[model samples]
Target: MSVSVDSPFVHKVWNDSELSKMVDGGVQFPMLSDQGGKIGTLYGIYDEEGGVETRGRFIIDPDGIVQGFEVLTPPVGRNVDESVRQVKAFQLVRESEGSEATPSGWQPGKKTLKPGPDLVGNVWKEWSVKDNYDK
Candidate 1:
């Protein structure tokens, strides 16, 4: 889901005029309206002076907890691929019940670090950057 200060009508126009061209059938998720920046304010992205919200992406867990988030100015576009990757990593961690941790750039089927005393200072031996990048 996406939340922005734009009204529902503006979201429709944006989908019709621009977003639709980039993704088939426009965005697949709901584009929520935050006309008064109320939701943005709660998320700390609301810019009172500009009356606009900075671009932000938040990943909330099933328990209503924010697992991760990213905020950036409008000039820099967000990375959807990276967001998806992070979501996958988070899911994997949750599935493991906190026993495993993903290394940087970790992907599905890649090596994951197990949290324990043995791994405290032996992460270098357990996993390497090449593990995340090697095919």
Candidate 2:
């Protein structure tokens, strides 16, 4: 991600290794070691049973309101590339004109659609392309 132009964290890991081990070694950045995940519990992002930090991104605007919040499983990679774009989009829109509701694949400099009657037709059009896709 460091090489990528548009990305959030410079580095990230999906494996469930002992985060404390990172502390033992000399990591340039300081990491909050959640032994029993007490801090994680307060944030409601800690996995007590599983004993790991759930991959998540918290995009809080200047007003301290969360514009975007995403949490994903360990197997699935979190899109840090998209998160940076989202943060920029949120800040830009908040500065220019007040709006909400970011559509899928939303990115900076791209047109963000405002949710209303107009979106219904667009959504319907997309739904029409049914290929029996499943998660």
Candidate 3:
């Protein structure tokens, strides 16, 4: 889902634009219009003077708790692939019963860390990389 301070009419216009058409089979996600910036302010992304939210992405759990979030300046673009990966990571951690934690630059099929007091301050001994992360 993407939320903006624009009105629904503006949202509709953008959704129908040529750039938006480049989305695979058209946009599959939700685009919410926050008419008065209330939702953006709630998410702490609304710029009062600018009256627009900087690019912000939030991963929320089923219970409506925010699990992970990223905020980017307006000039920067958000990475949809990274956001998808984060959602998967959150789901993985949620199902792991707190026994495992994803390492930095973790990807699917990569090893995960078992967090514990003994693992603290010695994580480098457990995590290793064959090469730099491609992402």
TM-score of each: 0.92, 0.54, 0.85
Of the two candidates 1 and 2, the one with more favorable TM-score, higher being better, is: 1
- Candidate 3 accuracy as TM-score: 0.85
Model 2 C-alpha RMSD vs. true structure (Å) is 9.4
How do the residues 1-135 of candidate 2 rate in per-residue lDDT, one tens digit apiece?
011111123233311244336556434443345567665576577776787767666787777787878877668987768788778877767875765454555555445556667777686553332322222
The TM-score that candidate 2 achieves is: 0.54
**Reference-based TM-score, model 1:** 0.92
The lDDT, on a scale of 0 to 1, for candidate 2 is: 0.57
> Which residue pairs show collisions in model 3?
none
Consecutive 10-residue window with the lowest summed lDDT within model 2: 1-10
Off by over 4 Å in 3: 117-122, 131-135
What are the C-alpha RMSDs, in order, of all predicted structures?
1.5, 9.4, 2.2
